[model samples]
Target: METLLPKLDSVFSTDCVIFGFQANELKILLIDRNEEPYKGWRALPGYIVGQDESIDDAAERILYELTGLRGLHMEQFHTFGDVDRHPQGRVITVAYYALIRIDGQQELKPVTNFARAAYWHPVKDLGKLPFDHQKIFETGFRKIRRRLSYQPIAFELLPEKFTLTQLQTLYEAILNRKLDKRNFRKKMLSYGFLKELDEKQKGVSYRAAKLYRFDRRKYNKIFQNDLSVEG
Candidate 1:
């Protein structure tokens, strides 16, 4: 006897929730769709995964094509496979998230036909996004919030050399609450992964805060261990 399965129309897609900390706020990269189903609507940077391409490779290609950004570390976070997620067909999307420092040198001119433009929107102010993207962003945000307690991923969103206050601001932006300044500083410094540099913040009207860098060498040695903190 031979068994047959129904014809499958399923396909894969990659959605990226690229987070960045700028102006002391947490923002996610979004694209304005140029084509329908939801033309002109804001959406996460995403595209269908090619049949001949690996999902990771597709993610990189899609991100670069849609946002004109490259070399940022994107990590797979979740998979959204709801039957009604996509309008045209069965698109089971694998969601990836990345934390990048928003530098003035990096321009956000999208080079894709699917998007009219690419821009960063504050995570708190992102009004109803298209195609379950709001849900995707919410999930990614939660993952980062939970991961922050144990991982040093926050460093990715800060400048190469940042002040302790800047670091706290990034954390508060992600956590969406005020953290104990003294406790936050003490806990972070106790980790021994922050390298204090002789440099200080410049061009600010107030007193210049001393700068610190995340020591990757010490981070590597302590990667297995984690410093937990509360907001």
Candidate 2:
């Protein structure tokens, strides 16, 4: 192994931008950097990969160390290898973005010396961020919006049991367009993935709508291979 090794001039790292939906707005988790170059600036939590760790392993390890989260259904969407992406040296970073439902998780308290705090910032009103993160964030947000149109991704962003109105609101927020409720509900219902609960939404002033949950078993059974709609 030593004889087959060639000297390397760069290190690999993974930076994850975790997006969570709450209060009907898109949010991204950022860590306050405590290191130099961009110290005290907010950035996506990331760390250098271990010498023997795989890229996937490094990503999950970085996520857990920063957010106290694991198994986030993460996906590596892009690889950012700009020569100056890192001021430290030649560092190639694999950028990953994920959407983890915040419905049942504990408050994130990132555990790392480089990061002083971890918090969720609304995607709409973020100011300046460290590195090329603003570009990375924009890329991820665009992908999410495009994915929401053809896929039932609202189930991932919403609570366990939500009203159709709430689901439609999520789509509106993502697509930035209002959808006809009758048409939306009709198409959604035709899918047969929503399981109507015997319960109604509580704590609302107006006439409460019934709650429904996404049936994964039925969903997989319905669209097992390709995602398409038939008229």
Candidate 3:
């Protein structure tokens, strides 16, 4: 009998497009690459997957290793397998994206030498990225833009207690358009899942705004009824 092994040409990697909202701006996390094919260029945090690791586990490891953040709401959006996508050989990549709240407390320090540093770049200020990452990011961004219409993911990117204006700002940033204030408030309130809080925002130079919190219990109860009706 003879030993069998995988081909040297077959390689797989995972790339992440981590998105965050800060100062009313949509941003994506990029790392300064330390190794070649595209050394010194900024790119999505990514690397070759371990042979024994599952794709999901590999994504979690890669994201944490490059960004030092964990427990994110990561979702696999697409896979890039173009023959020339990688300069080294036949490398295929699985791409994932996550939306996180920028609380100003999280530190981003790459754990591996492959990346020198990690930073966030505003979505609108981005230029051409190294490798096929530009296309990978575009695909993930479009997926999130479309997913926003059907999912309540925007709530995940807001503070625990936020004003209606803050909520609207987040939605407008993701959708990339102005939403009518009156209609937006009406539709959001109609859901009956936002609990109006007694406190107002502090530290503002001008008039303070009342705060509201997302009531998960109310949302679950309301949507359960809708699902039951549809079922």
User: Quick one: best lDDT, which candidate?
Assistant: 1
* Whole-model Cα lDDT of every candidate shown, in order: 0.90, 0.81, 0.85
Alpha-carbon TM-score of each model against the true structure: 0.93, 0.88, 0.89
Which one is best on TM-score? Answer: 1
lDDT of 2 at 222: 77
Global fold similarity of model 1 (TM-score):
0.93
Q: What's model 2's overall lDDT?
A: 0.81
Tens digits of lDDT, candidate 1, 41-60: 99999999998999999999
Relative to the unseen true structure, what is the C-alpha lDDT of residue 91 in candidate 3, on a scale of 0 to 100?
A: 86
Per-residue lDDT of candidate 2, residues 1-231 (tens digit):
457768876699998888878887767888888888798998888888988999999999898887777777788888888888888788888888887777687667777777788888887778998788887878787888777656777688788988888888777776667788888888888788899999997888999899999999898887544222223
Name every residue pair that clashes in candidate 1: none
Q: In model 1, which regions exceed 4 Å deviation?
A: 1-6
User: Candidate 3: which stretches are off by over 4 Å?
Assistant: 1-9, 224-231
lDDT pick, better of 2 and 3? 3
Error of 2 at 6 (Å): 5.3
Specify the poorest-scoring 10-residue window by lDDT in model 1. 222-231
**Alpha carbon RMSD to native, model 1:** 1.8
